[model samples]
Target: MVGIVVVSHSRKAAEGIRDVATEMGGDARVEAVGGTGDGRIGTSPEPISRAIADAADGNGVVVLVDLGSAVMNAEIAIEEAELEEEVVLADAPVMEGALNAAVAAGAPDATVDSVRMAAEDAQRVKKFG
Candidate 1:
């Protein structure tokens, strides 16, 4: 099964999103990482790297970011982790993409590309008519 990481500026938000995603993921490995070491509202590469490594299970990891520095930090974390597992950041909405990726990752046939694609597909989701 593919793993997932949800990144946000606020620790609460990241954990909240992970909670929601996990409810729909069903045993899928989803990690929530955000804020600085001191619990400030900011992104940190160290914790993000740790989350990436934690989420990895020799399958792959799909990261979902809230915005801006989150992406940069995720990139930095990816580089610093030096993981052998294929890790890719999904360019999708944080909440929606996390949900989609979580569900896809729970599938037995799920792959990194498939999970990432599912997350990116959230970009096309319609909320209201």
Candidate 2:
């Protein structure tokens, strides 16, 4: 069971994405980390790391980032977390990728690399008409 971590510059956006992923039905652990400690429009590594720890249930974790500093912060968090579970970053759209990853994570045989690939492949699915 792979877990997912959503990182965004806006707290609401990250949490909203997590809610949707959760509602989609998955056994994976999903968590969101966003906004600065002061609630400013920025990302922090500390909370992001904690989110990864919280979501990871021994299995590795996959991270989906919104944009801008979120990427850098996620990378930092991955290193800072330093958990035994491997953490991988997906280069895909935030919400869609998170949902895709969550679905993959739900699989009984989901792996960190597989979940990351699923999230990255989400870029192929068009969102609108």
Candidate 3:
């Protein structure tokens, strides 16, 4: 199964997205990485990477982040780990991408390619509309 990680500045946001995705995806692998420095759920690159690695196992990972910092941190984590699992940092809007990924994951033929395509399509819609 495809693994998805949602990174945001707020824990609630990450959790909320995960909940929605889970409802749609049904048993899909979903994790959260929230920013630190506040009372909210927080995490660093290392922990996020570890979560991604663990969820990925051997399949692959798709990371969705809220902002520039979150994206950068996730990227750094991916680079540092050098994991074999294909990691894709989605440029799509957080909620939309997560939902799209969830839908893709629900498919019996879900693959990294399909999930990436869903993410890209979602991003395009967000960008255009």
Candidate 4:
């Protein structure tokens, strides 16, 4: 199964999103990472890297980030982790993308590209439609 990492500016938000994703992910590895080391409302690469490493199960990881610095920090985290497993940042909304990716990750045939594509597909979801 593909692993997942949810990155947000608020630790609470990341944990909440991870909770939701986990409900649909079954036993899939989903890690939440947010806020600075000092509990400030910001993103940090260290914790994100740790989360990425923790989430991986010899499979690739799919990262869904919230806004602004989360993206940059996630990128840096991926580089810092220096894992042999592949990691890709999905160009999708943090909440919806995590849900979608989680479901896709649970699939038996799930792969990094497939999970990332599933996350990116969330951009087409209609909430009020």
The model with the greatest lDDT is 1
Decreasing TM-score order of the candidates? 1, 4, 2, 3
Off by over 4 Å in 4: none
- Candidate 4 scores a C-alpha RMSD against the true structure in Å of 0.8
User: lDDT per residue, candidate 2, 1-129, as tens digits?
Assistant: 788999999999999999998788456688988999999989998999899999888889999999889999899989888798788999999998998898888787789999999999989987586
**Residues 1-129, candidate 4, lDDT per residue (tens digit)?**
789999999999999999998898777789999999999999989999999989898889999999999999999988888899999999999999999999999898999999999999999999897
Clashing pairs in 4: none
Indicate whether candidate 1 or candidate 3 has the larger TM-score: 1
**TM-score between model 1 and native:** 0.97
Per-candidate Cα RMSD to the true structure, in Å, reads 0.7, 1.2, 2.6, 0.8
For candidate 1, write residues 1-129 as lDDT tens digits: 788999999999999999998899878899999998999999989999999989999999999999889999999998888889899999999999999999999888999999999999999999898
In order, candidate lDDTs are 0.94, 0.89, 0.80, 0.94
Candidate 3 residue spans exceeding 4 A from truth: 37-43, 126-129
RMSD of 2: 1.2
Q: Where does candidate 2 stray beyond 4 Å?
A: none
The superposed Cα distance between candidate 3 and the true structure at residue 34, in angstroms, equals: 0.4
- TM-score winner between 1 and 2, please give it: 1
Candidate 2, residue 20: the lDDT equals 93
Task: Locate the minimum summed-lDDT window of 10 residues in model 3.
Answer: 35-44
